[model samples]
Target: YVTPVKHEGVELNILPPGEDLEQIVEELWNTGRPGPEFRELLEKSGAYNFYDFIIIDSAPFFDVRYTVLSIYAATRYVVVLRPSIVDSRRTARMLRRLMKYAKDFGLSTPDYMARFLGVINLAKSGTIEADALLNLKFTGVKPSKGFNPFKHPSDERRKNLEKSIEGLRKVINFSNYVLPLNADISRLEFKEIIKGGKSDNDLKNTTENLLKDIWLHATCQK
Candidate 1:
């Protein structure tokens, strides 16, 4: 059930969590069958035609049924990844599961994969970001094919990380999506904007440029 809620004068439809909804979910799971309840609600209301877009954010695990339903409904999917080893490892697991699920549903890998956009968040300087950049470079190149940055005899997650990075690179190129958000100049400019200083123009230009690319990638009809 999506209820309309207003935030800062903007209207947004939100699904409020409650026990009643939980009971329905549990019953749906126990029955092990797809039901018409949600479809009926969506189709009958005709609200789907009213909105320009609907975005679904899922858990790290992808959570099976709900994740499948969301992906089935999505026209485009954007993945937000933190620049770090642990986050890369987690992303590898999540993306592999998502791709497998998509394949099982008879979706073409190229078509399905094309709709994906990747964004690297909170990218900072030093060894951590450098290591992350290296991972991104060999993203789709398999460990068996060539030298892998993550390769280590003791690191059990090396293969998975390699594959995950590859999957991400296949979708989002580093030049487009990797924002230098944590750099000293960027931080100073943003701070000035936040403080209502002279960097207002800087902030506006920066955000507009960033959002232009992001919006184009996310909403552009392929």
Candidate 2:
């Protein structure tokens, strides 16, 4: 029984830890291999019928059985990261491991491998630190305006903000991804923003443009 936070356009099904389900997953991982029952349970979760897309936010580490299970069930993956060299490198390594698992299960063909999505968050424009993201080879997105967690930096501190954004932009550019600069909303305003009105339209437009290329890549297989 997956307790997903059900929504119209998105369903957030979290893989919880330290629960009864966790124990079962851990036992499966101890075997060092996936079996028929594992695939059956994952398929019977009914995600495909319930949602147009299912985004699995797995654990950061790969040792956990739940994380591997989530990756096995995924048709597409979206990797969200801040623009940093460490984050980029870590994600790259993670993808490598996930692909290795997929290949073991006969799921690592070109079509299956093409479903990975990358995204850079809290990105700033015109910075060298941001360039580190360019080293990665994948399609991704960045916020149009950088997220300033400092909450209205004083004039004296404004320079620091500029520097932060500059660094992230480098990562965004390096990844060759699109920038959804004005599309970000605060956590508090997210529900209301997407409920309707100009914010909703803006979000739709931004998402459409950002995903157009990805859609083509996903469906245009010859």
Q: Largest lDDT belongs to which candidate? A: 1
TM-score, per-candidate, Cα-based: 0.62, 0.56
TM-score of 2: 0.56
lDDT of all the models against the reference? Answer: 0.55, 0.51
Q: Tens digit of lDDT per residue, candidate 2, span 1-222?
A: 446676768657764454586678767767766544566665797756876655556765645555567666765555566655566566656655665565655654544555655555655443433332322322233322453344543433344434443444343222245343344544424445445464656454444544554554434421
**Clash count list over all predictions:** 3, 14
Shift of residue 66 alpha carbon in model 2, Å: 3.2
Tell me the lDDT of candidate 1: 0.55
| True-structure RMSD, every candidate | 7.4, 8.4
Name the regions of candidate 1 deviating beyond 4 angstroms.
1-10, 30-41, 62-64, 103-106, 130-167, 171-175, 179-206
